[model samples]
Target: MPGSFHGRLFPQNTIHLVHSSYSLHWLSQVPKGLVAESDLPLNKGNIYIAKTSPPSVHEAYLTQFQKDFTNFLSMRSQEIVDCGSLVLTFICKNDEEDGCDFWELLGITMNDMVIEGLIAEDKLAKFNLPLYAPSIKEIKQIIGKGGSFKLLHLETFKLKRDSNMAEKEEATLFDEKSRAAYIAGNMRAVQEPILVEHFGEEIMDELFERYGKKAIEYMKNYGKGIINNVVISLSKTN
Candidate 1:
């Protein structure tokens, strides 16, 4: 209905089934604490929760996710008929500390810009993604406490980073730089809007160009990666 899912977009008991893919991980907005008025940025020098992020920064993100996701469930419960089903698939965090490799790499690329006088350091410090990848345990608890749904099934799976290129002839033709550009292009499609909003469009090409190089370096050091995804089936309860 062209509205935020954080709020009800459907009438009570009107929907028989709902399906969402790769979307729930995006929170409605950035956590308030991270963007709160302050002399110093809360999550300085990085976007998203990084290895260097303070514990409070991590807590703020998790708290925001809890609030937003609970709202999502409550809103959907109102719209869905009794025992109506919800199927969702989205990125999720596993036991690994840094589940967002591309994001981290983007942050590194931005920081490199900061060092080269391409963008202001403070501007970089103040930016963060309005996204979170919850653990399965975290999701289960939230659904349980909400008391509006029964979890029918849940599973997590991984897809290789280059899975998109598997069938393409370009996969065989790509050199290191081509492969890196391909990966960076995918990230750019998702991130360009917010980045342009904050940094302006002047740097878009330069930004992704540098990002491609960083992606190649990252793969050389860490090997090609995998994206983690979680799929869940839920039924509304009376």
Candidate 2:
């Protein structure tokens, strides 16, 4: 995001309303401390922060998110007019996914690929998704500490990510094969740019292709992913 404020991207105190959904979870850049001074990767077997990750890796990610979100609020607050509103929607960490966590399944799939030599361990270590799902309390704390805006309303809801696909007629049901293709296509549209930039073109096709097949298997075994989506409306008082 470049932390642009009152500059070319956004002029100060001119914008009235801003809307964002499911995007703020993404960090402006990859979290640091993923690699040690020895140039060895700090987070070695998984993609994003995984359940088995060391405490340091977890702390590193949390620190990065705090820094990024604080800066984001600071920047945008300057561009907002008095009483201008910012409505943000984001995913959170919760047990609302039944027993299936999409991120965990994705991590397992990536780790499986590493085990099978489909992708190198170092590559996995080198790559960390620039994403962090903050809890609702953490979100409120960051906003409160930002000091430029006052939160007006907050709501959280959980829903199956692909429930409609399952509710369709048997003939129209999303089978593993069809579901894999669709999931890959949809996610690739959004993630491919950053992925390619990080992992390059050679790994892009193969990685997502493998991921899609694994994702289908995961869906069959665990149903769809569930998420706690939070919406927060805040007003700039200063």
Candidate 3:
């Protein structure tokens, strides 16, 4: 389940439709050549490419995303039937923001915890979240590179942080705690093992606890920053 699509072969020409939701933005691994051997830390005091990150850092991440996504599309094209459709709903990076801005703010909190002597600066440097949110144009290029899947439909949707926990009875009222819990749970499912692997078991509870609180504050202030997501439907053509 963890291997690259190129490495893990699927049954060729068996599948009809594929639906990938809230996945595929994650790279298979950390980008190589993050920093030169001679120079100091390229992304010092930060866990990811921030709004202030240098152009080289952004280039490194985009390059890696292109490679991994190309292979993913190529493999899927071989597995699906002719004219089979694939619907992918993934976070997009646009004029708005990545769906994972919570992660970005969390990283900043981690830096503050380091300043407070709660965590080691080196640990922060070693930990980089392997995530990428591609734009529609970038996705098109990836699919084009495979030369198998034809784009059928593409649409953009927004997810407001406050809207994640709306009640069925009343759309205006928000369940803040439930919203926080849901976001925290999803993040824990994806990131707990990684955090534990790097920072040990002790940091898990406190880290995500802070993350949940940060999520609340983030929504309160920035109002989800109008997170952008793209739903792309592609068809395999013979």
In model 3, state the lDDT of residue 53.
Answer: 64
Residue range with the least summed lDDT across 10 consecutive positions in model 3: 1-10
Location of the lowest summed lDDT over 10 successive residues in candidate 2: 1-10
What TM-score does each of the candidates earn?
0.94, 0.85, 0.87
- Clash count for each candidate, listed in order shown: 0, 0, 0
lDDT of 3 by residue, 41-93 (tens): 67766667787667777787888899888877878888889999889887878
lDDT computed for candidate 3: 0.76
Residue 161 of model 3 has an lDDT of 46
Number of colliding residue pairs in model 3: 0
Ranking by TM-score: 1, 3, 2
Whole-model Cα lDDT of every candidate shown, in order: 0.87, 0.76, 0.76
The candidate, 1 or 2, that scores higher on TM-score is 1
The residue ranges of model 2 lying beyond 4 angstroms of the native Cα positions read 1-8, 95-100, 163-171
Clashing pairs in 1: none
- Evaluated at residue 220, the lDDT of candidate 1 is 74
Per-residue alpha-carbon lDDT of candidate 2 for residues 1-238, written as tens digits (9 for 90 to 100): 4743222347788889988778788887788888889998777766677766788887888888889888878877888899999999888777353554666556677677778886677766788888888888788899888898999999888865455555668737556777677666766787788767766677667767777787777766776556678889999976
lDDT of 1 by residue, 53-172 (tens): 898888998999999999999999999999999999999886565444677778988999999999889899889999998889999999999999999999999876667875687678
RMSD of every prediction: 1.7, 3.0, 2.7
